[model samples]
Target: MPLLAADNLSLERGGRQLFRDLSFKVFPGQLVQIEGANGAGKTSLIRILAGLSRYGYEGRVSRSGAMLYLGHHSAVKALLTPRENLAWHVSGEADFSDRDIEHALARVGLYGYEDVPSHALSAGQHRRVNLARLYLSQSPLWILDEPYTAIDVTGVGELETLFAQHARAGGAVLLTSHQAMAVDYPVSRLDLTAGIAS
Candidate 1:
């Protein structure tokens, strides 16, 4: 069975029909992209899928294992040092530890700044901290919104590598990004403007 399946989904906001008749399924090790212009309801769709909304969806979305949702805003605490922030997340439910945090940061070029407060870090650096969860999540499904924002070229490259590894390991991913992906992996896109992709 597919890891996740959504059938005839729909969502609305402020009485406006954000989207309708959406459907898709994700299998283990598959990478899916949700594409749409601004205001086309990509984020709303994710919110529905993540169960962040109490109601409004028209269809069922079933999944196995767990799913992690990462939004545009960094979940990092600005007042806390990078190590402290990362540790808290790890302890609070993330599947990584200090070593994993350090390794992830290093891979994203944030080495040597582990002890500094997130507020002291540049926007891009702060963004990197939020991304460290990608390595820490161990969840079978990742629902990320514009994860490439503020990340440098190398960081994006690392994300491509991460995606490859995750899919190979039978984890699934669903993401939305304006930029194109660099990996050779086959991606099935759901384009909202066209009213849900095939």
Candidate 2:
């Protein structure tokens, strides 16, 4: 079975029909991109898949495993250091040790900034710190929205590598990004403007 499946999905906002009758499946090792113009309900669709919303939607959305979600916001505490933040972020789902937190930070190029408050980091750095959750996460499915925001070219390369590694390891990623992707893995795109993709 696909890691996630959405059948005949629909949603509305402010009485405006954002999308309708959309369907798609995300399988293990697949990188699925959700594409659309502004106000095309891309973020709304992702929220439903993440189980964060069900209003004004009709659909059977199902998933078989754990899912990690990173929305538009970085979702980090400004006062907390990278190490403290990561430890706090994943503490609910996984028992991440200090070594694990440090390792994830290092992978995201935040090694020396581990103890510095997030507010001190640049926007890109803040985004990278949040992305370290990808390394710490063991979820089979990842739902990310605008994850590349504020990321530099080097950071983008690193993230693309991480995405490829995740897919090669039989994990799946569903994401929305305006920036072009340079991943080596085959990508399946669901363009909301064009309706559901087969």
Candidate 3:
């Protein structure tokens, strides 16, 4: 079974159809990239797949396992430390220990900054704090919307390695990134702009 399947998916916003009859699937050990020009509804499509969409759409979305989502904006609490934010964001079947959380933080290069409030961190650091949750997730499907925002070169490389590792381990990732990936695994792209009506 596919990790995620979208059958005849159609979404409308402000009475205009953003995408129509779009069908796709993310299988195990695969990386599916969602791409589009601005206003092509990339974020909307990601939200629908992540099950966080507010607007109704026509389609059937099937998931074989749990999904983790990272949005374009960092969801960290300004007043909370990175440790606290990661603790609140970690979920799913796997339980994360404090050591696991610290390891995740270190993986994201936040070694000495774990206890610092997120508001004090730079924009990229804040993003890293939010992304640390990915290390603790065991979800088979990851829905990421513009996950590269505010990340530096090193962080981007680390994330690409992380995604590649996930795919190699039979997990799947669905993400939107304007920057071309350098992952070792194969990546298939779904371009929303190709089907959108101009």
Candidate 2: segments with Cα more than 4 A from true spot: none
Give the lDDT ranking, best first.
2, 3, 1
Off by over 4 Å in 3: 91-93, 196-198
Q: Write the per-residue lDDT of candidate 2 for residues 138-161, one digit (tens) a residue.
A: 999999999989988888898988
Residue 43 lDDT in model 2?
A: 91
Question: What tens digits encode model 1's per-residue C-alpha lDDT throughout 26-120?
Answer: 88988888888899988788877777866667888888788888887788889998777767766766556568889867767778999998889
Candidates 1 and 2: which is better by TM-score?
2
TM-score of each: 0.92, 0.95, 0.94
TM-score rank, highest first?
Answer: 2, 3, 1
- Looking at model 3, which ten-residue stretch has the lowest summed lDDT? 189-198
lDDT of each residue in 1-198, candidate 3, tens digit only: 799988899999998888999998889999888888888889999888888899999998888988888999999999999999898888444678889999999999999999998889999999999899888888888999888899889888999999999999999999998878888878898889896321
In the order shown, the candidates' Cα RMSDs to the true structure are 1.8, 1.3, 2.3
